[model samples]
Target: MNTTSTNCYLLAIESSCDDTAAAILLNDKVLSNVVATQEIHEQYGGVVPELASRAHQQNIVPVVTAALRQANIDKNELNAIAFTSGPGLLGSLLVGTSFAKSLALGLNIPLIDVNHMQAHILAHFIDEEGYDKPTFPFLAMTISGGHTQIVRVDDYFRMSVIGETIDDAVGEAFDKSAKLLGLPYPGGPLIDQWAAKGNPKAFPFTKPRVDGLNFSFSGLKTQIMYFVQKQVQQNPDFVSQHLADVCASIQYTIVGILMDKLKKAVKQTGINQIAIGGGVSANKGIREALTQAEKNLGWKTFLPKFEYTTDNAGMIGIVGYLKYSQELKDKNNYIDTGIHAQSRLKL
Candidate 1:
């Protein structure tokens, strides 16, 4: 039974997937953010969810300690604990959610529930001190490894998915294509690097069949597979020799597909302010596309600098700060240890 109105420091933990991350955010100021990524799973050609969970169990504590140290705060000075509650690996989310709840109960402080994807959008605000922040009624495109969606964000906590994938997500498409090309498990970054050197027009890929603002990447991924299979049949060294070109071709096609829907979302939502978030947003091609859209469509665009585009606990902490400022948090928000992860969540 803790009820206090005093200003406080927020501790945020994130174990939604392969990374175990933690941070300390005071108000809207990010004091420290530390992340521990599980590198062992890379050899498996993709994340093994169970392995990711085991890694979180092994890494959560040290990561949190590092975050607290970076923030220069002792555990006793903390105000409340915040963590991602859903839309991630159930086992992974449980690690952070349960830890946060237990810590809050022990410290007699409040707890905040954070939506991982929403935090990715709000990541734009972390560490920004007294700077201009996006107002209500803006558009956010959350493109990550597992999910791809364009959302209408009317406020920090109030959002709705305007459009999304009918099949594979953009990031998943990237990794899957990379795997076929004999690239590593988390092939998104590999695709980006390879695309940088290759000609984007080298290989042609068809856009999705879905209309309007929604997205579909399954067809494009299939096209790449068949295209590559034919190439390999002719020259077994095709991917090895033309890796850059295939990456360029595939990356270009994917970015083009996203831009098509992004433009429409703006037109239909009638919101000129657009923002891009998530790991895929870190791609240089997407950055260039958004910049072009800004100039061509006369729309205001924001892409968080490359560092903030990926999964990080600082974003969760920032969202926690926003909710705290709005008086919308409670210790009771803590997990019951029976929580689950949702592969998808609205806005």
Candidate 2:
């Protein structure tokens, strides 16, 4: 394997959650990214950890094969392997970690450990045609089912969490709220769709009064649950009758809470460039809000391509390529084969 930057072929595996994903990258450019989503958890309304890990075990081989096949590359041609190491289900991470370590050792290549949250932020750096990357000292807000955080990015590896969720993540709030409304699992996108057709101000939900930059969505979730109960008690068919309005109002309040914190973060950090990542960054309402902020508030907001917003191996691959490049400079970017999975890793 050539260690030169020009010929760097990296394989990245992401089994941080229910999605078993694999990607092949030549340097910073993604050649193939494949994700196998687990639909088994839908019936349960949320991801079951045991079920998720089992699914990963089943999907890892075929997913990686597909990724390499689609990239038109052989496994032995890869120069390095990367895997998400933390801030995810331990069982799920273990599956990817073990595979990555075995493959790297078999091929006599370097193994890289990637931080899941950092991958979400650095995903913006993936070499895409029209997408522009954020420079140093930008603020990144990662919103997903398992995590929600505002980070200050100084470099590819240098980041500090300035604010984060005190309770449930924004994606969980969306899914839980959708569940309360009797919607299907992963209800965040459905709420975004309905919000477009309804009046945002139809029903007002109070935002949680968290000081400074930290967030608390648990109270907001409780508020929505109580509001739904009261409404259904008064009128048995209330949700069915006013589903759109309720969804719009809920989305509006959630977006407002995010924006308020972002504004505070900007004021505190004096950095106007705002970049967002994670699964909830796929929300249409949030995208619209960021676009509006660009025009109305003179803020430069970086929104990732939809594919990179979710849990995918392409993000991991980009991070791997970056780390591999840095290793050429510093020689200390490689990880040991004895590295273990971390269920709770911070920035």
Candidate 3:
């Protein structure tokens, strides 16, 4: 992991979930990010762990090959292989971890074990700088399918989760609400689309009352469920005709809860630098709310581009590249069986 003599080219693998993504990031700038999504799990209405593992088995090799091909990089030239190590489905993480280790061994290169959640936060550093970089002592809010947290990012490799949800994540809330509205799998995006057209105040939902900067979405999700259930029962055409209003109302409620906690984090931490990432960062309502908050509060804000907003290997590569540059190697990267997946990891 002594990187003074190391090259910057990295081959990253991300199979923390249903997406088997591979990419060649050159000096932290993505050359090709090839994500092989699992289409078979759509019928399950969400990610089916077993089906995801099967799809990863079918996609890893081809996806990695395509990434290298697209990046125009020879296997021998890759400086290292970075793979997601935890905070994801065990079966899926194992698929990417095993493949990356083998490829690293075959190429006689080193393996960089990446924390999936940390990668999501580090994603804000890709292909952009200046005010775009969230400065040290900054507050990082990561919202994803399974996790939501406010972190103190002192540096690229040094981060600490300061506040997090006791129950559901923002993305999970969106997906659950989408299910009740008859949306397809990964319905978060569909809800965002619907939210764009409706009035946010159309329906009133109570915000969570966590004591500190931490967040809790379980109650809000349950409220949405009951509200939708009753509304749909009262009028069968509720979702069909009033989809926009329903989506807007739900989106407003969630975004409100998220930003409320974020503002409180800013007040307590006294950090003006704020950055938002993860799959939920792609949300329109959240983006607008954060932008308006910046305007009202005079706090600086940073948002990753849409492409880097989701789970991807490119994010891992950039994070690995940062750690590699400062010789910040993992202390425990040598164990063979230690390459297994973890459902949670502290940054």
Report the Cα RMSD per candidate. Answer: 2.4, 1.2, 2.5
Put down candidate 1 lDDT per residue, 1-347, tens digits, no spaces: 32365565889888888889998987777788888989999888878889999899999999999999999989988877889886888888878877887887788777788889989889877767443466778999989998899989887778888898888899999999999999988999999999999999997888877977789888888888899999999999988999999999999999999888887888787898888899899989998998898898898887886656787888888888787767655444543444444544455
Give residue 67's lDDT in candidate 2 (0 to 100): 98
lDDT of 2 at 266: 92
* TM-score of model number 3: 0.94
Off by over 4 Å in 1: 1-6, 129-132, 328-344
Q: What is the lDDT of residue 255 in candidate 1?
A: 92
Q: TM-score of each candidate? A: 0.93, 0.98, 0.94
The TM-score obtained by model 2 is 0.98
Q: Please count the clashing residue pairs in each candidate, in the order shown.
A: 1, 0, 0
Q: List, residue by residue over 123-214, the lDDT tens digit for candidate 2.
A: 99999999999999899999998888999999999999999999999999999999999999989999999988889999999999998799
> How well is each residue in 1-347 modelled by candidate 3, as lDDT tens digits?
22465457888999999999998987768999999888887899989999999999999999999999999978888777888998889899989888988887776666788898889888877875443776687888999998899999987777888899998888999998899889998899999998889988989999979888778888988888898889889998888988999899999989988888888888888897889889999998898888988899988888888878898888988877776666636423432445667766667
